[model samples]
Target: MVSDAVGAGEGAALRARAVGKTFAATEGARVVALDRVALDVGAGELVSLVGPSGCGKSTLLRLVAGLDLPTEGELWVGSELITGPSAERGVVFQDPSLFPWLTIRRNIESGLVARGVLRSQRHEVDEYLRLVGLEGFANSYPHQLSGGMAQRAALARALINHPRVLLLDEPLGALDQFTRMRMQDEILRMWQARGTTMLLVTHDIDEALYLSDRIAVMTPRPGRIDRILDVDLPRPRQRNDRRFLEHRARLLELLHLTGGIEEPLAPGV
Candidate 1:
């Protein structure tokens, strides 16, 4: 059914070619947010971008979402150049950003309403509510839901549009450790069920390993792809598994977080 829903070649491959972004800083100075970044994500595959703060992770996600444009180079989804926002791309930020005044059902239906397709697609609102396990709370307002529940609502909202590529910008970053882990599995389930291409930006290394087929690490300021590491671990990976730990250590080293490397000793010593 998901295959039928998504259609072959409909998932959409993403390509960024020598993409760069710059912003005007204080006093006529310019800040290079990203530089010469090139990456490709296959159709229906999940990839994550992880790096230190200020490394342009969110900037790149925004570009893919069509909320922002690259100052240089180009981005493409499938065969089409990414010129502006499209329903084919759906974005979920760290914050749910649901309208406080709307019921959860209304919020999920909002996208269809915006596109003027609600008459034919209204049934999908309840379908996605069931998919996200929020059926019982359809009448509830955003204030009544917990952080995880609110995020689920947000996901259902985006997914009702059947986005070819789902752009997640730290969508689980605000939850507690346990909730964050649970939501990780929830997101994986959604990815599996829908077969959508996904690009996730996250600060959590383990989350990236758990969800992504490959992990792209970026450098600090003037962010560029430091390396793209393949995560070959099987699904339902054990966090304590030997291979998992190995990958974790490697990513930590890449991020310069483990303090494992020391300066060379003096030649005299």
Candidate 2:
């Protein structure tokens, strides 16, 4: 069973406290990218991280992924301290970084192979491929597929690992509107099917509201968690609902308060 720390069902899940990151420039100047930010991703939950440009959303994702260590604070995944990248946590970036020379099936299976799964377990790969709606594209190479298809393959690759948590860094950011909407549904379906804990970083507030149980709003440089907005909309939420619109307006108001919007403030009309 998945630990409660990660989901709603059982086991205490991942937690981070006072996390921060800083970088030193070649010019001998120090840059602070994140402040003492704290967050918790309960098991079986989809938490979307949304913020203005340069808010260090992606940086925070990387820190949670164990790609980099925080300059301060603590991060724990299922009682384990996050020191570096591990198979238990999987990440999908904006671009589908698949190997062009390898067939899609091989690409997805490669991770399993590295983890020492028996050759007989190769069939597990197809399940993920189908889960991502890429059943027919298995034999195709990365170059032969479109952006969305390649991303599907990437998703299959990540899921094949059966990681306890999935970190998505703007995975659907580059798709066209129609494609993006479709992919969002696909992702939600997969999340329901697997019950995997997910943290998605996105600039689109609408997308966040659509996919997340809660949305974490971050502040500009030296990023901090400014707010945590719970979405109480019932399952299968409709975009046109009055409550949904009200929530969106409230989020926009918060974003504006944090200087995320730059439009001229009009007099109450």
Candidate 3:
């Protein structure tokens, strides 16, 4: 079962401490992207990071995904220290990033192929295709599917690896409003089925409210987690309900979008 939050114990599936990243700019000067960021994502839990542009949300995610190394601090998945990319951590980005030449089925099998286990896991491909509601699209190439369908393909591809932690960097951000909402439900359904610990970086507060068990708010630059708000509402939350609106308002206040006087913020991008 999913816990409320990660704690001092071993329930934390993902953990970061004093995490920081800096890059050498064109000049001799350096740019500090993240500063003393600390967070823990419990096993089988869904957590989201919400902040304005250039807050290093994606940078932190890349660190967790092992795509980049932090200039400071420690990152851990289970008891293992993060050193480099591994099949154990799956990632899906804003763009689907599928191979155009391959069919959906082959694309999903790509992970198994890379691990030299296609012979054993070939049968799991169709099951994952079905899991993502793309069983019929298996034979279709990336160019043949709609935007949402291609994303479904991408989801299937990442999930086929069965990573212990899934890092989502605005995977649904590019979709239209309707499609994005539908995909949210799809993600929830899959999460329930797999119970994979997921960390999402989203600019959309409502999306974070809808998907996350907890939301981590961050400062604009030299990013640090400003606060973490627990989503105490029941599962399958209603967007129009009073509790949902209250949480939205609080998130807006934290994001500095709401004035001292409260105002209605428009939903969706």
Candidate 4:
């Protein structure tokens, strides 16, 4: 069950309007990484971005995190324009990136400490540790934990700030199948408990179907949102259900998989 206290606050809405990004290549050539992408994640909504590699999914996520600014257009968390990184938007990448010298508790507390609020918000350290099921590992070093456990610790570190939007850039991509599945559920639980809006970037179509309220499919390089599909399945969705299979087929078709294209019948044939 989700903790009422964690789930109590309202989440911030996220919007990307005509968002574009460009990069400079050799010989002063310009590469368009993203072009006129528009997206929205409602407050507390879990949205996933899925596409082929180099489609700028991670780039778009970085812009949202304010790690990088969009070359053109705008991004917003609630009504405030996003200019740079803020604690309100926390990011977790594929790597846990925990400091080897820091204990789980210390790593989780690092965010609060950086903001000069550790003295006042110290109690949240324990709360988040337990929230991620890491209460017993607080004193353990990062090197002592498994990959999944380390990622959980990373998640707790981000959540301790009570971020309004959590940006996940393939955070579960490195886990083995079983562990990945388990972590998916763990992430969902945390999302519900905290009501934090989430924007997840993943290559796994099944993962997007299983975890997101909607999935935005992007085109190849110079990425653009080709389609946005709503997942209407109920919570704890069944992977083997007919509707689930139908949705999977559709997405695969959009990605040009399954080989067969739908062609209209010739008139009077």
Candidate 5:
């Protein structure tokens, strides 16, 4: 039985007002990735974005992280408009793009080092290593670790900055089932411990249902919010529970409407 998942605290507030993005395609064509994508994330809340392929989930995340400017509208982190990347926000992509040349500790420390942390503050790096269950692997290089371990290092790198918000771009997509489930639990624990606001973009409905306070369903290309589902099932949710199955069905239905698999196989048979 899974224990109930708990919220960290009041999450930092974020708003995307009429945010939209367009890219110049080959041969003078233009591709609109997102349109009027407006959403709010409350302080300390874990909001998940789910959608069909080409739904611009990643684009929306980038907009919130301030890594890309919206073609129109604006994104705000609290009262300030986001202009560029800052230590205030951390991002974890699907690939655990750790530095192959650096030790796990060194890679995590690089974030602190970039902020000009003094030698005395280096203890912060070691603390985060332990936080991600990588205490013994500190000196190991990225290639020496397994996929899951590397991803944990990526997570450690993000958290060491003490970011107010963590943007996860399908960080667990590459992992197998067992590892993915374990990482899911670890992410929840970390969120509980840190109380930082998180926005996760994923293709997995079960993952969204298990982790998010609310799941935003999106349509295909030029993605816009299709519907928002408030997940009421208790945390540490049981994947096999009736309530969990019900939400999963609803999410699948919405995905179907967006031209995803018309019938997603039932949960684990």
Candidate 6:
């Protein structure tokens, strides 16, 4: 029962061209994190980046979040080149990372307060809380809620800013399996309502398959965009359906997760 999980008209086009990121390591050596990576996410779309450990998925997210600078190439949000972090792009990390001392209501409004606009924007706080299904918990402290609830609050906090692009770095990774599944549905709900573009980083293949409009598979360290596959399946995808399993098997082969690394490659369907 997922509505096509796309954003309304709230998203801004995102583009990255020949982007590269490198860091200095020990012994005067350097480590390249991302290399010649190029990608695009159309307005209101959901795209996922998936790869093995140390593959720079998070690095790419950080660059887009404006938390770090790239060594080469360019990144853009709609017409503007990304030179630094802006309120138009918001991020939710694996850790919800809510403040221990603040109530959910205060946490959600913290951003507005920081921007010195809380006085003018306070009326919107309750709306965003309800948007994430956290209205009843507004007064609750971070420790008073369960992992799933806190993540919801964190999501609400980010959404309240009306970011044009939402970056999710394994936001549901800490939840139990059941909670994770439920949160997936919740994410779709929010996406449809806000129409805000989303770029997600995840290790879960099924999660990518179920949520992404397209999946960008990255190579190991010094990560490159090895390939991007369109998910042509219909909404409310059945994880056990024939096509679903076929895509899953193909993805496993692409990632070398299956026992066969020599399997002939298939073009994206």
- Candidate No. with top TM-score: 4
CA shift of 266, model 6, Å: 27
Stretches of candidate 5 exceeding 4 Å from the true structure:
1-11, 118-120, 261-269
Off by over 4 Å in 3: 1-12, 257-269
Clashing residue pairs in candidate 3 are none
Candidate 2 local distance difference test against the native? 0.83
**Candidate 6 global lDDT:** 0.87
On residues 28-83, what C-alpha lDDT tens digit does candidate 3 reach at each position? 87778899999999998999998867778899999999999999999999999999
lDDT of each: 0.87, 0.83, 0.85, 0.88, 0.85, 0.87
Model 6, poorest ten-residue lDDT window? 260-269
Which candidate leads the pack in lDDT?
4
lDDT (10s digit) by residue, model 6, range 77-133: 999999999888999999999998999999999979877889999988888787777
State how far residue 37 of model 1 sits from its true place (Å). 0.6
lDDT value for model 5: 0.85
Candidate 2 error regions (>4 Å)? 1-12, 118-120, 261-269
TM-score pick, better of 1 and 2: 1
Instruction: Residues 1-269, candidate 2: write the lDDT tens digits.
Output: 11122223322257889998988855787778889999998987999988777778888989988999999999998889999997778899999999889999999987787788838679777677767777898899999998998888888888777778899999999899899988998888778777888999988888999899999888777789898999989868787889999989988988877767453432220
Name every residue pair that clashes in candidate 5. Answer: 4-235, 5-235, 5-236, 10-43, 11-43, 11-44, 12-43, 12-44
Give every collision pair in model 6.
7-195, 8-195
**What is the lDDT, from 0 to 100, of the residue 152 in candidate 3?**
85
